[model samples]
Target chain A: MPKASSGLLSRSLAVYFKDLRLELRTKSGLNAIMMFGVTTLAVVSFALGQSGLSPKVLSALFWIIMFFSAMSGLAQTFIREEETGTSLILNLTAEPNSIYIGKLLFNLTLLITMTTIITPMFFVFTDASTDNILPFLVVLGLGVFGLVAATTLVAAIISKASVKGALFAVVSFPILMVLLMVLVGATEKIFDNESLSAVSSELQFLIAYVVVMTTISLLLFKFVWRE
Target chain B: MWYKLVLFVLMSIMIYFSFALPAPQQQIGESSRIFYYHIPQAWICVIAFAMSMFYSIMYLRKKEIKYDDKAAIAAKLGFIFCVLATVTGAMFAKVTWGMYWNWDPRQTSIFILLLIYGAYFALRGAIEVEEKKAALSAVYSIFAFVTVPFLIFIVPRMVPSLHPNDSIISEDLKFNIEGAISLVFFSALALFTVVYIWLFNIGVRVQLLMRKQLEEEDF
Candidate 1:
């Protein structure tokens, strides 16, 4: 059992690194995501123009940018494989679980990288302030994890469909609505100068959302991947 | 045919009682008359979605085309009922809350339900192969249903909302509704379930026939 499990982990890591190398070399997914994120941020900041937005609106705007950025790039993980005809090779080499894990890890890396860059830019451009920095980070971590976990399986599903672009966001937005709602709530509270404990329920919901989403995605990914 | 006749008679009586029997609610007055129609539409919407999920699971387990047909038909009916619920609820909100759309938790949840199934139909449309479409949509159906509990029950209660909490059932687990209101409300709920079942059966049969016709044409 241990040997089999270790094999799974190693194979998954192999898939992850393969994706990372491809991403680094081609830079299509990262470039699209970052360019979209930065451009949207510029347009939003330019449009709003020192209006002194409320915390609720600012928190919502932050996650909206993240959401659209994810919609822009995350599907590239599987779509690339399908488009380039590499999925057949990957399917032969690794188990569905391993491929799912690898792609999930790859998407996580892309999303975290995008978040790290876009977040500070978001704060600077909008002049958004959160009194509780530690809690804000925690919320951001959980929120991003939940977002990627939920979208990864969806990316796989949409890759097989004939129509790809807007379909991904249309299908994913409803599933991720619960995650976005909780993230916005937690971030809004933090921006309102409330302590972490005040938003504990929202944090707990975020944790629960991530756990539930990842579990189902892992369980369901094989069905999507196999066919 | 007899059951349909009985349904017609029962529905007429129910509609009549909903309007003619109960006294106008104290606060919202006659606007509360929408409760019978609105709540039943919402209840049946959830029921149809649950049925869709059940059939989706069945399709995945048995790999049967019939289950896929049933699942898709149930979703189509559910989407229709969901729209009915939303429109009816919006009218109720307009009368009571002085607005057409409040973004209340219930309202938001139902709206998301609409979008979820809208995406379901879109996904079906995007796939041309029969088995793949069936399998993929069944998988998507199950995934969407897994989020319904969170969307309907948990998220709505998480925030303070203008939606009434104790209108039907109280904290003490007793029915807050009295006499005629309770009678018509429960009757409407039961009747709507039957109505959904009737529609679902017809839809599945029609879908199966259409597929059979298409297959014959292909040959």
Candidate 2:
């Protein structure tokens, strides 16, 4: 990979292209994420009795699927790189900040796309009606951003652990608190017929969290990746 | 080590103030004395987590094992402060709420924090390799600290509570000599921080010494 200027967006785009092409050929990451999302929703619905899946409940369900689904997807982000011995290759060629942003963008894409596909399936199966789907989507969208940034950093750390999959949750559970709280709070408003304006504060919080977390991740990626 | 004297001086000052600091204008009398320990411990807990997260990130960026050691020390200190906070809060609850553990939001949140950090140390001990241990521990510390705000801020809002709701300063509850009270609190925070630093330095040196001893044996 040729080195690009330090503009995060451009670097992220480049790395995204690289991962996208690899993903397109393999389709492994996409297939795995979607499968995890659908399966998780199915299990949750079956266990909880689909009758309880109201629109408000669906909103909460939507973020839960994204969370756990993205978790499984991200668990392997750095692991796959390391397993293939390409982590060092990629790290050597790309700056740490670029790698962090690139991974973050890619993870966000994975989470959002999976949520989009799985959410309608949830509505269809559970017969839930979301009054204002836009707010729900926006809340989920902001949440996915926080998830990607937070999980990406964690995924980097757990990739070096002896137990990658199990440790990912241990590492991410704490960091996911704010996003989960905001997601649940904003999602519950769907039941009460509140305006999107109510969720604006949470969305702002998510955005601030994303900025702070990603910056820290960017600075720390180089050290963690050194291994 | 020099800060030990400062800690003693601050401790004496706090003790002196504890006697004179009037009770809040409400029902509580001598029970309010718990605020000095309870509030400062909460502050220290937050500070310790912040230090752990900062050092964790530094460890990842610099690939310095020292940062990992520092993070671990910070986390241990944070855990200790959290325990003290929980105990003092429980003591306060026993006096004010007529129960030691009411499952209040603050109590529950502190328990959650304890679990998270407890799991952190457990995870560190389970991992064997030097590099892998540092990396995994750093990741956990970062994530766990990131979650602290949620435990501190959001969990409390999840349910109603008798614990005084979040307020930096309450007008209704006034300390006539507020400046002196703040100085007392600030001194306690600084004292705890210095003690933490001293302990952390000792921990790092001990670990280094052990590593050197292991290397000699290997040779």
Candidate 3:
């Protein structure tokens, strides 16, 4: 049993690394997401035209960019597999659980890398400030995980559809709505210089969202993956 | 036939009493009458979504076409009721809040509900293969239902809003319903649920028959 479990872990990691290598080699998914994020930030910053926005508006804008950027790129994880006809080889090589975990890890890496690039640019462009930097980072981390967990399975589901792009956003938006709302709320508080303790409920909710969404996605992925 | 007649009479009585009864509260006055319709529609909507989720799970477990049919019917009915609830709630809000739409927590939750179920139909429409449609939609249905608790319960409490969470009970959580209002409210709830079940049965039968006809034509 121990050996079997280890094999599963190794296989999952292999799937993750394979996707990572593909992403790094092609850079298509990463490039698309980064360009979308940066372009949106540029457009938004240009539109505001030096007028300072409130924390509420700024927080909303930041997550909106993140959400749309995610929508633009995350589906590529599975859609690429389908488009390239690699999914059949993947199915033959690994279990659905491992494939899902691997794809999930790849998405997590992609999104984190995207945010790392976009976050500073977001603050610089919008002049958004948060006093509680640690809490803000915590929010961003959990929000990214929650977003990926909720949408990874959805990416798989939509990859099978004819109209993949629009369907991906329509399907994912409602699922991510809960996560986005909590992130915006917590970030707004942080921007207002609220203490970590003040946004604890939002923090807890984000943690719960990630855990619940990840678990549910793991359970449901097999159904989407098999056929 | 007998039950349908009974349902018709009960609904008529409920509607008449809802208006005839005194205002549930003095301040909201007659506008409060919308509650009789609004709450029941919202309740049926939630119940129908739950039914859809239940059937979806059964379909996933049993791999039966009948369960998928039932689930789809329940979702279609749920979506209609969801829209009805939103419209009626908006009407009530307009009467009381002096606007057609307020981003009140309850309003926001219902709006998200509409989006969630709307997405469910979009998912069903996207898949071409029948089994794939059944399987994928069933999975998505369960996935969407999981977020509903957060939408309905947690989101409202997180934000301070004008929604009257304590309208029926005070802060201390006391049960306070006038005798006449409770009668109308409970009856409305029961009758609306029956109406929902009746519509759901009709929908499922129609769906199964349509599918059968399609199969025969193919044969």
- TM-score for each of the candidates: 0.95, 0.78, 0.95
Candidate closer to the true structure by TM-score (higher is better), 1 or 2: 1
Per-residue lDDT over B84-198 for candidate 3, one digit per residue giving the tens place of the 0 to 100 score: 9999878877776677776777777888889989998999898899999999999999998899889877877786633554353131123245698888889999999999999
Q: Residue-wise lDDT of candidate 2 within B52-140, one digit each (tens)?
A: 88988887677788888888888898899899999988887777667888666567667777877876876787678877788767866
- Which one wins on TM-score? 3
- Order of candidate numbers by lDDT, starting with the best: 3, 1, 2
Per-residue lDDT of candidate 1, residues A78-97 (tens digit): 99999999999888778899
lDDT-wise, the better of 1 and 2 is 1
Clashing pairs in 1: none
Model 1 misplaced stretches (Cα beyond 4 Å): A1-6, B161-175
lDDT of each prediction vs. the true structure? 0.87, 0.73, 0.87
Candidate 1 chain A lowest-lDDT run of ten: A1-10
Which candidate, 1 or 3, has the higher lDDT?
3
lDDT of 3 by residue, A91-165 (tens): 877889989999999999999999999999998889988778898899899999999999999999999887899
Off by over 4 Å in 2: A1-11, A50-59, B1-25, B53-67, B90-205
Writing each residue's lDDT as its tens digit, candidate 1 over B1-219 gives 999999999999998998887543655578777878887898888888888989888988888899999989889999999999999988877876678886777788999999999999999999998888988898898888888888867776665533554342222124357777788889999999999999988997888789899999999
